[model samples]
Target: MKFLGNKSVASFLQVILTILLCSIIVGMLLQLLFSFWVKNSSNLNFPLQLNNSGLGEFARITTPFPVSYGFYIFFWTLVYTFQVMTAFIIFFAIRVFTFFKNNDPFSYKVVSSIKWIGVITIVMSSLQFLSEVVINIYFNHLDKLENGPIAYVRFNPGLSGIFFGLIILAIAQVFLEATKIKEEQSLTI
Candidate 1:
């Protein structure tokens, strides 16, 4: 039997989607390997890019725990964990868009995919906040005791991501209700 598919997107869109998916996967792999190599073989500092000038803005190249080893492991694990989650989010989006390209916009699968994306977005933001706190704490501990503790913070105004996730979540709900209505209408005839 022939399967239903989205026809709104042109054939070239599918090709582009495939290219994006492949590149994302490759990039993640390269990052993973690079992280390992740098952490184990070199003192490459992993710059914790933050919107702050002091404390927690930077972590030691591989791990942040220079004095304590546990913090290093914890920080690196957190970094990789979020990296994997981000990769999943990107992959999920590509797949959902592919469904749209095939014209399956109202399908339950697409709605679910969107919901998952929103969930991950919130999760990623939370993880980043936690990471900021951890890095700052580490740096604060390292601050010279005689100099008085440097009061610094890396607060991520995570508004844009949260807003975007909320919007996506709302869109998913709308699409789900629309799908239900369409199904009901079909059954009545």
Candidate 2:
């Protein structure tokens, strides 16, 4: 079936984003439960395995598994931040698409929503990076290193989302200008 127009695509996206948002909510809940379980579990020590096996070879093993409190806190913090910010971004995206489906694609509210999405994207990416730093710090602490040369910054830096957000900001700027031109044309008649 062919999509009628922009509305069709927007409506479709709205549905998808709604599903994703719901999933995020459920995921956050599950993670919380899991963290609680881990924290309260009696078996504080489990098998710790690290395998760097070659082709058709066996594996290796490491020390026992001991989940530190700092690690637990860091994990939960990262999960909560990433999940909530992601949900925020998707929620705003849904609003933007809803505007298109409602036949007001270039309305002020729509443009504003896009701008918000862009800002939120940038913020979320930064938070993701920060999360990595938190985990790295936790590891360094666990290793008993005062100032060891260690870093946990991911190489990619999650730029794709930031780039996409910047593009959306550009689109919002274009819409703002086009909206002005349309108003001027209407006034001439």
Candidate 3:
């Protein structure tokens, strides 16, 4: 509601935020579906006995198409979610910076909050990526036999770079806001 004070900026932020939230929700759902598929796959025998080449080949061949599809969906969802969230944070930092330029009294608090949120989001995203990498490595190692068309997809480094850049921008916004607040305090005195 507070954001609605500035009609244009508020509307823009609302639209972007809505898209980011929806993407995140979809990503989570896709991940859940993938997890279920992995859990229920009978071909992926427990202990993952890599010694038996025939069984390994059979395992790779027998992996359900749906499971692979689910993984693909989850991967893309994650990528989009991260990109959208990063964009949202950058948009917010820009808005806060604009407020600072206008000498708004609340700019400091807003920018600080945005920075903290960006930091938290970045940390959560990093953890999610790490978890995905570990899972991929485990599955790849278990699936030793190259039976069918092996789909090897790499995580987008550009997305990570964007996230890092957003974090830095957020930090800069916070510093700028703090300076604005200091200037305001001096003016008031």
Candidate 4:
């Protein structure tokens, strides 16, 4: 049950991450193509949920409206950007696993990858929060039926994701200090 080295858990995880990375890329591309196809078809009416009034009311309320092409593209762009960032996080995680498998726990690459993961996670979380706000406002204006505040914007900016990102950053700092100590010890010996 070793943490590092060949044929260990790290190596197995690296392989799994590699596969996951490929799958995400492929799936995203396919989704983009399908989205375009769906857009071109005239028969399909895109359903827009006006509000989350209540559990029973929400399920029954749905309005089919023609969303502008520009808005549709913009929304998908935000979704795709988030997905790409997610893929990058996974890619960096794979790099960390690769280092571990090679028994290089204190390598600069490992520390850098971990730091990037934290930074990306924080950015991704914030971007998602902002995008949600923008989409809500846009939809509210689009919904002709609702006269006042059709979409209520929640003040709750997803703090949990940001907190998790900060924790990861702290872990990266610890890894950095460990790397420095390891280097100093090697020099002394």
Candidate 5:
């Protein structure tokens, strides 16, 4: 069945891509806000009440995780910055895709912006992965007074998922742009 004249397939694909793009943008914004909160409040101490002598001893002996206030702030700031950049990229990707799908000439500026955004997202995600690994390794060898490294390691999965998702989205955008280029070339010929 034909829909939207002869462009049913293209229209359908564009609609789905637009929805996915919007969802990613919203998710990135929420993540940015959460990272900001974590960074800002990283220094606030949360007292834990201990009734058991064994638990109290464990807590006391541990050197209580040294709050590297600066590191925490820097890490989260970087995350927020990258997420916001990724959102902008997604916005432009949707715009470019819609434009091309409608048989309109694609904007070179938008295409260039997507390319840079994809590259930045990939680099930022890599740095985040490395930072998390380093933090986990350092925390694992903490003294008896310090908290166990499990907490640091435990947070890895969620962070990794977000990073991987961004990478996948960026790659998809590259392929989508490539197809648009091919279609434009065919039309020109």
Candidate 6:
């Protein structure tokens, strides 16, 4: 099997990524509709319970309460933005694969797409981290003022995302250098 061209892994992944991209778009649209419906509907209460966790004493929240509309909208907006960013990353990946299918691995378009993916991933990861922190604080404190710290900081899962973004950025840099070298070779006699 060839590394590049229509019959190679890149082509297969391109097809898969295309399908995934479509699915994400459709899901986002559905989520938008759901958000509108939830906003207009009344008597809907969100219950938050942490005692169900197998950890006996580790769990803090035991009572269920309704979340505010402002928080709900904010949370969903953050989540939606994250999904959009993820779709952009997938879109860029698909572009990269398309270039691979065309046997143009070192093209400027491929390098640019890869770089965008890296940059978006980094920004998306930062947003996710900040949102997670805010959400966690809301859940833990439930907007109650107590004699303690302003916010309880916890280890966030988004750190892994930042690491992956940095890795992608490094890969993009390598690809840029490779493209430069390839262009130079083409120019040489």
For each candidate, how many residue pairs have backbone atoms clashing (under 3 Å)? 4, 0, 0, 0, 7, 0
How do all models score by TM-score? Answer: 0.71, 0.73, 0.45, 0.85, 0.46, 0.81
Better by TM-score, candidate 5 or 4:
4
Q: Which 10 consecutive residues of model 3 have the lowest summed lDDT?
A: 42-51
Clash pairs for candidate 2: none
lDDT of 3 by residue, 59-168 (tens): 23444422455555565666556655655665565565456444463655665656656675666567576756855674565356543334443454335744874866
Better of 5 and 6 by lDDT: 6
Q: Can you give the lDDT of residue 116 in candidate 5? A: 61
* Candidate 6 local lDDT, 1-189, one digit each (tens): 787999999999999999999999999999887887765663433333345675543434332345677887897888798889989999999999999999999988888898899889879878877787777777567636433322344547677778888898889889989999999999995
Q: Rank the candidates by lDDT, best first.
A: 4, 6, 2, 1, 5, 3
Give a tens-digit lDDT track for model 1, residues 1-189: 223355444334556656776776787688777865665654424444444765546443354334456765786689678767877776677667777667666788888888999989988787777778777777676655423333455567577777888888998899899889888988999
Please, what is the whole-model Cα lDDT of each candidate in the order they appear?
Answer: 0.69, 0.71, 0.57, 0.82, 0.59, 0.79
Highest TM-score: give the candidate number: 4
Off by over 4 Å in 5: 1-66, 105-114, 141-189
Best by lDDT: 4
**Which ten contiguous residues of candidate 6 have the minimum total lDDT?**
56-65
Error of 1 at 36 (Å): 4.0
Q: Which residues of candidate 1, in runs, are more than 4 Å off?
A: 1-14, 40-68, 144-153
For each candidate, C-alpha RMSD in Å?
Answer: 6.4, 4.8, 9.5, 3.6, 7.7, 4.4
TM-score of 1: 0.71
Give Cα distance to truth, residue 159, candidate 6, Å.
1.6
Candidate 6 structure, TM-score to reference: 0.81
Which pairs in model 3 have colliding backbones?
Answer: none
